[model samples]
Target: MTLEAYNLLGWKSETVNLSFPDEDSWRLDAILYEVDSQKSFYWLLFTGGSISIYLLIYFIQKDSLLKAIRKSRLLFTILFPILLIYIDVNRIEELIHLSL
Candidate 1:
């Protein structure tokens, strides 16, 4: 279901076969907005691709694959609500779709 899972199944990219550990330090990140359907594709492809590729590369080789993913999702779950509050308080335009 995820890139890390795919990596465990032996799929790999040519550019970063042995570089998975270093790549694990990164995650999906972007500047945000209420994207229209057109812009949403970039967000999905880039974010999902980033998340999937990183997971595939990193998790395939790591012993703690599920732990890392759970931690990330947990952190995001805890943090995003506060971010939404900040946006609502300040009336920021970024990522309005998220609150919706």
Candidate 2:
């Protein structure tokens, strides 16, 4: 179950009274807010960088659009799995261990 689903179930349950200490509650909220804001900022930065690079490539290779697209596709295909593996290496290792 997802965090939201779990939270909803907890809310519906009569025994679940989720309350943190006052100082810790504010600190947790602040940390969550900071994490959210940082994620948004990083996402925006990545999007802007991608667009800028695409535009630059488009401008530089105006006549070779097909070649540029092919190169981009190849690059993405090669990098995508590497990125996925990099991000999920821990999960992948856990699964391998479980299987063994």
Candidate 3:
């Protein structure tokens, strides 16, 4: 699925295998390089905006920071699964549209 997505996005990706000097387990890393710079720039901008908002909220609600943090965590726990489902559904919709 990941490879398919990378191919769809016209990105260059490679899988690398690494072994630790002392450990027996080997690790496989999928490196995706040569990504679209415009997408990367937009993602960085969105992440920065999210962090700025979080910091602003933390500072403004300093006295209730802990409470706010707890609430945020709870909200994330509740929303994350739904968000994942929505993303997956959107992906499937896109795939179906492409196939048709």
Residue 38 of model 3 has an lDDT of 31
- Identify the leading candidate in terms of lDDT: 2
As a whole number from 0 to 100, the lDDT of residue 45 in candidate 3 is 48
lDDT of each: 0.41, 0.48, 0.45
Indicate whether candidate 1 or candidate 3 has the larger lDDT: 3
Error of 1 at 94 (Å): 31
TM-score of candidate 1 on Cα atoms, chains taken together: 0.26
RMSD of 1: 18.7
Model 1, 1-100: lDDT tens digits are 0212124356764331122234432321221232233244445445655665566556657657677665345445435444544444343233222322
Ranking by TM-score: 2, 3, 1
* Cα-based TM-score, every candidate: 0.26, 0.38, 0.29
In the predicted model 1, the residue pairs found to clash are 3-56, 4-55, 4-56
lDDT of 1 at 74: 40
Q: For all candidates, what are the clash counts?
A: 3, 0, 0
User: Pairs clashing in candidate 2?
Assistant: none
> Could you tell me which 10 consecutive residues in candidate 2 have the lowest summed lDDT?
1-10
Error of 1 at 96 (Å): 30
